[model samples]
Target: MRGYQEDTPPSSISGDEIAGMDDEEAVFLGYLDEMDELVDDNMEEVTDQEEEDTDMEPPEDLSILVFNKHVGSVFCCDLHPSGKLAVTGGEDDKAFVWSVQTGQIVFECTGHKDSVIFVGFSFDGAYLATADMSGLIKVWKCNLDENQQEPWPIAFEYEAEDLTFGLWHFGARVLICGAVSGDIYVFKIPSGDIKVLQGHNTRVECAKMFKDGVRLVAGYDDGAVKVWDLKTNAVLQQIQANVHDMRVTAIDTHPENNIMASISSDGKVILATSSNGKVVGQLQAENDLETVAFAQDPQLGFFALGTLNGDVGIWDTARQMVRHQCTKSDDESVVGVTKMIWEKDHLITGCLDGAIRVYQGRSGEKVLQLTGHRSEVLDLCFNENENVILTTSDDGTARIYKYEINKDKD
Candidate 1:
């Protein structure tokens, strides 16, 4: 057996030494120094605050209901159609269906061997689907008969290549999932009938269904966007790969128009016709885009884009210009947005800084900021009426917030 020997520690490189290095090496050293300083500053701030408020309690106004059953980071969450219940999945490989009003677990979805990355309710609240990172998917029948004594029975289950995202059809029991194997799987619930939509050997990063319910638009990691005819499992149209230089972060379609908008981490936004995938308009951003959402009303003629640098822009689709630059709250740190939705004339966003913020879509003003989680918000969703907002976070809790527009701000 060979004897183990400890390697000598490297001497610290000085600023002068870094300056004399090549451009790439000097830049790398500078990034390291900046990161070190940032860590030191955050540590100092946290230590000081801990010492100052050792016995303080958090305010009760943070959330209306908090679901703390998850043992690890909650990765995904969805609100029930009735707005009375919610389903959340977490890193602990479990999913919980809980009451929103009282924060009581209604169903505990178990038997997963990996982190549950996605959980959603079917359109009519008839079924709940939970998908894990290892491609295990389970669908449980909801709203069971009151006389039944057993737990909710599993309606459907399947295994596929590692899953990236999953979504339920708006009007049907169909469920669609994207996989790392560059395939989109559509499963009709209970029956487990499968339809495979083949992709161009690249991971499907995100997808959205057209309002017509027959067409689906999918964005790929290699910067391709394809519109698929779900009925035939054929590609109806596709945008060229050169349109975006990097992975598509998010995508949304206009409610009334035949237009689809997709944003990339490379700071590019492409607006294309969903019918033909023709490139109609494009916008460039200064920072990497994280999320995108279109106004529900076609008359608004605008969409919102959230960036990784903590900036939000409301773009006028017709005029191809920024209409309003929404600002964050003054007290918030520069934690980027992770998800967003447009409800009526307002935009609700979930941030990495563990805050749910509401902005006025018409005037681009920050209206509300709700906080509770101590870590990043991973996912969020709202009810049909937009009155109940549910968010899951890395803090191992899911929070429910009641939302109401402040007419006084108008």
Candidate 2:
């Protein structure tokens, strides 16, 4: 596992912090807690997630349909904006779709020969895209109402060695992707045209589109965060990458602020202003974080980070401290977490033990403990429209659960 980099006090910049947008560092000082390992490395990974054998059957506690046919480890799952269709990618070299209500495997799209590390649907839900470890990215258009074999039509396909995937840094639409050669490729959709932004000292880890996709913010393994102009494809701003000499695992943008949050393989969680390239706040974690998510509503004012230590920390980004800590008694580190939007009061988390636990965002109460995957739970998405949860497990399955949600009455 990589280690967290120690930080000096944040850069003192003026006229950048958005007013009434979020709390300042002084306010965050009160929220600091000792458990949040304040070490040198912010993104240190606790442990790497090992692929569970796909041959195992899902545990009965879960309520969704098992994907049932993939031969490799599933890495991620995402639901369409419509909430009826779902998609998953895994180590098995396949990406599958399922009915959110029926638990039936409606589509199993396969072609990539390597592990499918990430998968996503477009903002409008018109397209589905998947990225593999080998840097292969494929786009599929959905037409599930038609024949199953034709559930998705092949749209765009590219390889790392050939065109170099700039797989839409934020979504299938964003114009930034990481090159295997350690460069940032900023390109828009459909045209497949690209502008290669060279300068990262190491491999680019993640990139994001900002405000209507006109600007981009990105982080790399070398520890630098660069803000770029989409129109000109120029480096507008840059933050040095030495504070933490580790891999950047996850990064998220504050919907309303120019602020960006990044977690490293070294275990340091940091916030930087994309507009000016400055750090707003920082938190140290005990283990390397696998995933991190910001709340849809900043007033609920939260973000969740899953650690390799089998723990989940619910942080109040405003307060600058973890308000809640969730840990499995066993050594089951959490791999994925999502903040439920419609139900802003809750969060959904997936762990290596294949357990999908739903918890209250405030009280940290365990709301539901669901089981379905035979192996580890890789990804989770919530469909508030139907009150069901979509999850993909390492057992080669994606399942939907619709358990009742009854509020506790006195």
Q: Which candidate leads in lDDT?
A: 1
lDDT of the candidates, in the order given? 0.86, 0.66
The TM-score measured for candidate 1 stands at 0.85
Cα lDDT tens digits, model 2, 294-343, are 76666788887777665677788777887887554324444444222225
lDDT computed for candidate 1: 0.86
RMSDs, each prediction? 8.4, 19.0
Q: Candidate 1 on 77-121: residue-level lDDT in tens? A: 998888887899999999988888889778899899899999999
Off by over 4 Å in 2: 1-59, 103-105, 147-151, 162-176, 199-201, 327-343, 403-410
Q: For residue 49, give model 1's deviation from the true position in Å.
A: 8.6
**How much does candidate 2 score in TM-score?**
0.73
